[model samples]
Target: MGLKYIEPIKSIVLLLLVLLSITFTLSIWTYTPRLDPIEQSPTVDISIGQRKNVKEIIKPYKFMIKNDEFMRGTTEQLDIDQIVNEMATWKITQLLRNPVEMNKKQMNEFFRQQNQFTLYFQGDVPLSVYDEILEIEEVNIPQFSFDRLVVKWNPKDISFEVHFLNRASGIHYYGRVTPIDTMKSYRSLVVGSEAYKNYAEVLQPDGTYLAVSNESLTIQKLTYFQEELSPTRFRDALFNDPNAVRRSQVDATHEEFGDDHASMIVDTDLKMLNFVHPAAETSESIKPSELLIDVIDSINEHGGWTNTYRFSHINPSYRYVKFQLFTEGYPVHSNAKETTEIAQFYGDDRVFRYIRPYYMLDDPLSEEVELPSGVSVANALMNSDQLDFGTVEEISVGYMMRHDPEQRVYVMEPSWFYLVKGNKNWKQYTPEQDGGEQYGLE
Candidate 1:
């Protein structure tokens, strides 16, 4: 009985040891492959919400003088004392460094360019004298007419006035001179020697004088002109109208498809569509009749081009069909020729009106897509059933579908295509490298 029990115990121990070994191997195999730390780490996710605050990082708005009022206000508000100090400092510095000299011509040219001079005359100076005065080396007469001269001068940094008047004694006399400084504070005054001497005094009837001096002048405070926004008459008209029709008309004027009858035709095929009748007047507003004619012309031109050297056949399986058209003239290459391809048309009768032949390949022997007279490519596509071509696909305008590597269907107005056939031999049809001759055989 003891031997039997010992044998059973030994077998049990062996079974336990086997199970333990298998468990250890399985645990090691399960965790043997380790992941790369960089690959396994979560990446930083940048969201659109985080970009909202980024706009605020743009530079601050800078203000500058943009109109006469702002300019006048800025000049009036300038600090006279500071300007005077700066002028004095500049003069002193220049004198210390061996005074720079300018010739009479140079001085005159500078004064004329700077617009810094005043004319002074006693009464009615002769035209000869006036001309002579203008001939003075540093004098420039006013471009506009004036009885009196009050000019801002550069060298002396002052405003001076010269008045010419007829005396009570029935004789002409000239002698009214006033310094701008006496009437107003000049932040800075610039005057040339000729201008300083010309308007230095004013003669009075009572033998008295009104002298302009530094004591009468004070620094003028600078002020900013605020810009006021006001509505124009046109804007008022729009706002006042209860119907709002005027506003719509104004808005329509700025649209590409606005009522403007003047259309820009960029057909490479030179298919002049009757967008505008010969007698129709092109104006700010485009008439619906003109647009209709244009659409028709576009379709006819495209059909004629595609049929010139190609023939397309209808596939029996595809019943209702649609045609997507593209035109040439992109990149404005003069030598480029127009080409079109049927990107996609459905065989299902549910979406199309009639099954028409859409050229899958550009073969010289293939039948061309037939088009009705005066029907635009857009209208033809939209009213496919009306044209008796096929059922129309209800795709929205501007929609596009890429069917193959070389074919794409675009949902646009039917008249948009001026040519409708893919040039499979586009490379051969491309203009010569020398740019001397056109690619296609005329």
Candidate 2:
């Protein structure tokens, strides 16, 4: 009886061990290792999609809006905050992952909407110098229209800006495009004719190119300036110490403006010329804006002031303010920043000196010269030893003086300058290019 009972308990214990072994084996075989979250790069969706039909209702809308006649525009942009807020309230999103129904957990603010991005993709159709924008093929995007596309090419920096809009959907898409060299634009746009270049090579008395005739002859129906850039009157007005020399003079030489006055004198002497006073500060400091305001005040006396005339540089001593001049509404190029036009000088919280354009063409001439395009000039400069640019600050066409070796008469030729931002790496081609050196010299 003892043996029988012992055998039965052994069998039962053995069976339990086998079952436990199987259970443990199964657990090991069926187990899986957790994987890391799938990684993906951040991307922005820039699709211009149409709203889904309202309960499948059909409503016809214009497929295209026409504004192709306008070449450039300054379209007022909708505030970014306002656009975002509107998108949020409408539960509208432009993300590609958007599904008919999404788990609430997927709604993360970190995700970007599927709306158009500031930068277009590489494969997108790009604007060309010769592109007849009106004829360009339209894209098949929802709620998107080719209408109201604003293309701006700035030859100064060789920069392009494109703004694509959908007025109906209120989508604003824009970006600064990388400029490309177009052969037609390059070949056809040179400012200097072959004759002009050849003439420029002729030696002048001052060792400069004889680009224009020194005789001061007819130019584009306008007469070249015969008189020099000189101050109109000289007067003494001393303060703080009578022993200190103080003198003021006015120049009204701008050939174009006829009798509009320009002045040159010490900063304090600005008062003598009836110029607006510089603001007083407790610490004897004058802000650039203050000087700028003083310049604006002179518009009545110096009539050529325009929105294009910008404050370019201020002297290290905080004494002088240089205002850049513009030609045909475009900024004159810098080549190297210098006094293309001297605006004002500051000393002891007063405008001590002033110089402005008192001489220019009397009026626009009908003779159209095929002036070199900004892009063409920039390209030539890039290849030439003259200027290795960082970014061209501005470009303008103006007369650069040439004189006869014998008569010493002044001649003017329309020249172009590319005002490049200054840096140590830049090679100085001429002394006139140095705006910094000008502070001490001019």
Candidate 3:
């Protein structure tokens, strides 16, 4: 309470303030905040099966060459691959749509030129996506889709020109091959393909020409053993959270898997799966190039390339796509059920629906049955009372899948397949059923 005590009191107060300041500074330097952890998407990384490259799924099923000397073609995988590999080496540029009107007659003339060859794919392949398969130089590739790539050149011409044709939409794209020397190699490959069969250029109602065999030839019928695949693999791969999913057996033949957002149905008897994801559905239209790429990636994510399935069809308007089962270089169609196709319907950027078979074809039986030639088959189809020739878009040799209940095996009988315009169904044409005579070119 005196002057002597005042100095000591002030000193004590200053020391306490300094200690408080030091405490505040230390607390500010090492402060730890309490915040919630970041959440991750459940389906970010899902793998239930083997993945596949884009080239494996998107490949040509037929290759045809027409020149002044011969008209021949082949469905052999090896032959097709050889030509595709050669084309892949060439740099293609100036991919633009040919605005010139080309009718069926003009197109046929183009095909029957001095030297030309065509590679036919099963679906409308966007040129941008096909950049993965072909060596394309143009970075600003336009939005164009093609089912056929026709390479044509004349003996006098220095360069070979490529035409991408969409048979369904009647759209044609033109591109050029650089370094004219590529033509010599391409021509040689075409010349050396002796196994290619003789074909007749038959014009169809759709302004497309089907190269049917002109002579009588035989095709072997294949019978394969059957193996069923597990549906659980798809469930685990598709569902956002497999652990939170519920399974329900509708009957002996039908089973279902679902969560709060999506559901998948399994047709056990038919060995098919149908997956639907409503939450991923969107009404916005997606580019064909983007759609095709996304669907392939989605299937590859779950190793969905179970069998030798090739891209068969695509409808960008409906956002529907299909991959058909192929055997011995021929597409296989099921008469009993839609068991030979892997189909997808897109909703926005995601898959809205996926329908595919769950069976894998084993090795074929040794005994082979013979099939009539494409000419005879075409004749039979032309004479069929049930089928109108006008509706026939194209004709080819394909295997008709028939299941033998007693033996528990599936038989792939090589037969003539005719594509209908309205439905695009590849109906199996039997000679006896059609009441048409088999007559090859004399």
Candidate 4:
């Protein structure tokens, strides 16, 4: 009897275990992971006809009447009937999921899925008028489509300025303004030249009518408008001739080198004379006196003779004559080459005379030489007091001899020296003129 009872209990327990196993299997087939309260639930598969109603889907969430502030607002005091009527008028039906509730990963997936339904509105629009409509208290959304979301609102508040751009073939359509009635329903139609036969209708706010086609037009039209405008001085100058001179007339006095003047003078007495030699090549044999004579002769021929002075015994015993050589008649060449050519021509014939000594005249002598108004010459030698008589007496004599190779005529320059007079004080005399008269020994 004990064995019979134990067998029946064992059979009953085995049967219960079998029933439990079947229940577990059925639960496994139907089970879905529970989502965190903050996390979006996983999407469940459903046939097209069995999709959840839009109202039922949004019923749990609070409907926000979009105020100026996005997330915060006063609780809508309207009754259900009033709310439904307002929503219907605005054509609003569905609520978009709040972006704040989504985590990074879920938000990314949602965006990926929702990007297909999002609408993009892009164009040039004035900001002032659009701000008024965007301040509305509430708006409604209506039926939705899977491929794209269609929303409608009254766009009465939108304002626009239209512009046209000429193209090679057809016209383009461009809308400029924010839609006050509908946010996502309105979109900027990017009409290309290939798609439209004429884009002229899109150019202005109220001009012409545009035609739409399905030919897959790829034409792109661009219109540029400047808000703040200014005129450039260069452009104004280029377009208009405001009495501007084509060639300016410079004053004769303002011209450079036009009134330049210079003169030659003997360095010994700082007197204005026609002749002056370069003190650099001076020698005892080529005395300052003789150099003075030669320079004076060259200046006379050059036509710039302003004044001349004779040397007198009253002024120190040295017999020196002074004169000014004017640059008024001096030859002016166009360039260095021309000047050099002229110099070479005079140099070959021993006619070129150095004008250094003349330019070295002191202030008193320079003043003596008459010059044109507003013209002056520098006295370089007056500042350098050292007389440049040659070092070697023989070289000086040789240079004087070579001064006129063609003529073969040699002349000794005049000089002054003291001679002892019968054991008394020395007296000076000109070697050429006085010979030895004033000198007692001679």
Each candidate: what lDDT?
A: 0.24, 0.32, 0.77, 0.22
Would you list the clashing residue pairs of candidate 3? none
> Model 2, range 1-442, lDDT digits (tens) per residue?
8887998899999999999999999999999979998899885332111122111111111011112221111101122222222212221112121123322222111111221112111011212210221122223223222223333344455333445533223444444433234333222222111112111112222221112111111223122332322222221211222233333333441111111222223222111122222332123454443444453343323233422344444433454555544333322332332224445655444445455433333333344434554344444544554343434433333444333324423343455543343421122222243232211112
The reply for model 2, stretches above 4 Å from the true place, is 1-223, 227-283, 298-319, 326-340, 356-366, 385-412, 423-442
The top-ranked prediction according to lDDT is 3
- With candidate 4 superimposed using the best TM-score fit, by how many Å does residue 24's alpha carbon deviate from the native? 99
Sorted on lDDT, highest at the top, how do the candidates line up? 3, 2, 1, 4
Window of ten residues with lowest summed lDDT in model 1:
57-66
Model 3: per-residue lDDT, tens digit, 230-279?
89888888887889899999998899999999999999877888999987
Tell me the alpha-carbon RMSD of every candidate: 33.9, 29.1, 4.9, 50.9
Q: Which candidate model has the greater TM-score, 3 or 4?
A: 3
Which number leads on TM-score? 3
lDDT of 1 at 25: 92
Q: Which stretches of candidate 1 lie over 4 Å from their true place?
A: 1-159, 162-234, 237-442
Give a tens-digit lDDT track for model 4, residues 1-442.
Answer: 8887998899999999999999999999999989767977895321111122212111101111111212111111122223222223332112332333334344223323311111111111111112222221225221111111112222353232121111111221222323334322223211111122221101112222111111112211111121111111111221223233132223431111111121122222211122112222221243332333343343343332222121110101122222212121111111111110101001221332332211111122111222211000011111223311111010000000001224322221111222121221222222232222332211
